[model samples]
Target chain A: MSVDLRSAFFYSRKDIFKNIKIFIIITLSIILATANIIVINGLIDGMIEDLVDNTVESSVGHLNIYPDNNERFIEGIGIKEQRLATLKEVEAYSPRISATGVLSNKELSVSSTILALDPDKERKTTKLLEKLVRGAAVNPNDKNAILVSSRLAEDLKLDVGDEATLAFENGIIKVYNVKGIIRTGNLDFDSSTVIMPMDEAYRQLAIDNMASIILVKLSDKSMSEIYKPMIMQNLDVNNIRTWEEETEFVSNFANSWRSISSIISGVGLIAAAISVGIVIYINIIHKKRQIGIMKAIGTSNAFIFTVFLMEAAIFGVIGVFIGDSVGYLAIKYFEANPFLDAISQTWISARFEPQLFYIATIFSFGVTILAGVYPAIKASRVEIIKAIWGT
Target chain B: MEIIKTSNLKKSYMLGNVEVKALNGVDTSIEQGEFVAIMGPSGCGKSTFLNLTGMLDTPTSGEIYLEGKDVTNMNSNMRAEYRLKYMGFVFQFFNLFNELTVMENVMFPMMLNKRSNYKERAKELLNLVGLGDRLNHLPSELSGGQQQRVTIARSLANDPKILLADEPTGNLDTASSIEIIELFRKLNQEQGQTIVMVTHSPEIGGMTDRIIHFRDGTIEH
Candidate 1:
């Protein structure tokens, strides 16, 4: 290192400790700014992750296999099920048949979608059983039992254990007992949907070994794109979609939240930069005479500028370190005690992302150094005669 | 040998909108190992002469030579490097850095010069100034005279060829002033140190080997 930089390092390090009180106040502001950015971003990421998880669990099970465009139902579904079981990538699969019907209670009637599923298979492929808001899940043997979504039950004034009659478009009518109430936070699914047993549905609709769609759960949801093509080739089906594609409704909201999070973080960092600049500027003003004396004694302008920048860098590192620790602890606390979201009927916790913390640390440090530049230049450019003589 | 020479050295700056000539058409030279005093009244360019010679400020269209090299138009960085390598400054205010210890203040020039064993050299200089025991004390902890002593010690840290003192004893008591002048005399006679001091006191001026008088921005014969 050059003498200017070396001397600057020495002076800056010692001076920071010498002026501990003022630097402490500056550091506190930096800590708050960094922590706010981290915590706010973490919460947004957590909410988005929850949305994606709920979409995968309650509705899209990583990947979905649908019938051809011209066909109402998939042919040879039993053979397809056997083929899907042979693939190691498939964790589990459930075939479902959806039929539009009129669901009526004693006092009210509403248009609803009757979704038929194998209860035992559905439990592995989706979260329908786990999301039960009230009462027990539908039993596979009890063909007369059914699960009704909270919104549909509310529209028909129906509750668990109540009898509701469903009239399909094919002139098939059946009365069933509502076994449970589930809320997936999916507006379309929760609003007007009723779940029933596949065996009973096939008998009532006069069909066998056929399904309108097959939901496939995978070991890792991120592999959906890779596995989708493989599944399509094996089943000879042209209609297949990944979970990310199936959750367009939630993805739009997630994108908006990400943009909002960036704006909030940007504002917070700018405030921190301004605070750092003002403090360093005031410090330079107070030490104007000292700077003049240094120049008089042959200290270079480069030395003066480097000293102030080094001091600012030290402050940034200390503050960001403490802020990162605080943010991490906060996320852990939130994880231990998650919020109960009424709409999703799920617990939401903050996500702790190491990549986000690293980026925040680097960006905050860079901003702090930039903030010190003007003040350091001003210190370096002090007129020796006027500064020393106070003219 | 001429250690320093000024050929029609001039400097000017605007006081409000009017240009004030601080120095004008002055020619002089100080031989090597000479102890000279520049005596002048207030507003007579004594400090300006000292500042120009010390490379702390630039002259306006005139030439200055230190040991035969014309050094009139060096930029700020080059001037700073030349000053560090060859000159030392003692200000009237005894401007020791208040935050640093006496030892550290003395070592500052050496640190800038990138010299090794600066701690030992600073200790030796402080001891010569009779502040060996006050090494760890801050500038604020010392008396006005002691702080001036520290400044003198700091000025000699780099072993510069010329020591320039601007009213070095102006803020000191009579007893302390005599001590500082006696220290300068001892340094000049014993070590052959070259010094150029600016002062208003004839008593201090009489102690030096030669005295140059100034009036209205020019030296009086």
Candidate 2:
């Protein structure tokens, strides 16, 4: 009464119901825009997360202790292991010896990086054991057993218990039976890589108690930066790198993807705003005569303006609610059946970030309200004579 | 006692860069409970006079007084307030909100006035217009005469001191026009309702207590 909010809401409700088809169409457009934003953003977030997880969990541990400049390999492994074992922040550590080698199965010869590791230690430090797709994990005591990536195994025509001759860069040759084939979903790691017992590597590479790098898995992966200095303070290593530094390429890619996502979302939201604005403007135009009649009968301009604005708010709330529901369902579906990224060779699931939902809701609702302003003002400013007579 | 008065009321506007004087230096007054008709030809400023006196438009020059209070200089919001408190308007087209039922349409003005008893009051007014049984009917569902009755009921929603109608029966057939005129006469006689209506038909104009002839934006006695 007297153009209060309740009366305005009453008018808006009746008007919307009277034009239910138009209301549904406008609301559906808003829903499309909002869901588009959520799904696209979720996929990008999932891709970035998948890339980071594979880099940190499958290969590069949270912290890697590498040989400092001018040094070929890290010496004093026993002392380093003892110091690393003393730290509570370190979950597990594996010392690895790497040598470029050629593996041939008589018919095919492929260049590969032979990584020698302690099977038990590598299991605790990396996801290598869990990612094994064929045969059993290499046993630490079995000197003749080796592991090969699924891609390399395919190239060399090797399988479980199949012997392949490996010739190291130093010309040391030996034949080892493949114990396992692993697919970590990292194309580089799966393409040209082999795993063998450390003892076998020591004999083949002619190295004594030296490691190319020590991969240290932290209890909390995110604490790599903070714990890197703490581990360095305790150990004698001068070159400790955090996972972020080791995965700079992935971080750069993620940043680029984020920028692209923002641009697309910006365009989408603006389109949504324009669509809402045009619909509201048309509604006002159709109601121009009624508005003038109301004014002629002593209804205040504020009342007419409030009624239209309330109509827009109703559209926004309903549209955004349906949009959020649709987006949540889509994200859940994608989580169950992940998207396979061919370029990265990873299966990425949509990540449900509550912040994304909140942002989309606010933008859509706020934009709809803003879109209502001009039309509402125009309705309030209608000249009674011209509007009534259509002059 | 005089309830409405206009002195030297002149209203001019630009019609595509050419000046159109809708009302020019007119003077008139309606006594309380007076049933008056403004009789004029097409473009004779009868509607303009009604619109200006009803506070629906501003005058280019002159003064309008309602119950001895000068209201010519009031701003749009003030005019709307005064109009809500004291004036009611009916248009040639009936102008009833098609979305609202007859009961809701009658209740709208009272609601705008923030009257708590709008429902009962609207029912009473609709019953007076012989439309009590049609309260739940939309204006589109009703015949033209019935819709006009609803408009009249709505015009009385706030119980304003004066009702100004521009060609209230202009679109009605002869029988519907007589019925509307009879309803107006009944309202004037029974409730002492003040009415100023514009009608071009001499037959309709002859029924009012008085007729003020208008021609070319000026009133003729």
TM-score of each: 0.93, 0.95
Candidate 2 local Cα displacement, residue B172, angstroms: 0.7
The candidate that achieves the highest TM-score relative to the unseen native structure: 2
Clashes per candidate (backbone, < 3 Å):
0, 0
Report how closely model 2 matches the true complex, as a DockQ value: 0.64
Chain B TM per candidate, please?
0.98, 0.98
lDDT of each: 0.88, 0.88
Candidate 2: CAPRI quality band:
medium
Query: Model 1 over residues A1-391: C-alpha lDDT tens digits?
Result: 1447778877887777787887788788778777877888788888888878877888877889988999999989989999999999999999999998989998689999989999899999998778888989877677788889999999888899999998887998889899999888888889999888898888889899999999999998899999988999999999998998988877799889888988887887788889889988988898888889888888778888888888889889998898788878888787688797877766788898998788778878888888889988999889988898888
TM-score of chain A of 1: 0.93
**Candidate 1, residues B1-221: lDDT per residue as tens digits?**
99999989899999899999999988989998999999989989999999999888889968899999988888888888888888888888988887789999988889899899999999999999899999999999999999999998998899888999999999999999989988888878887889999988999999999999999889999
Per-model DockQ: 0.55, 0.64
Candidate 1: give the clashing pairs.
none
lDDT of 2 at B129: 91
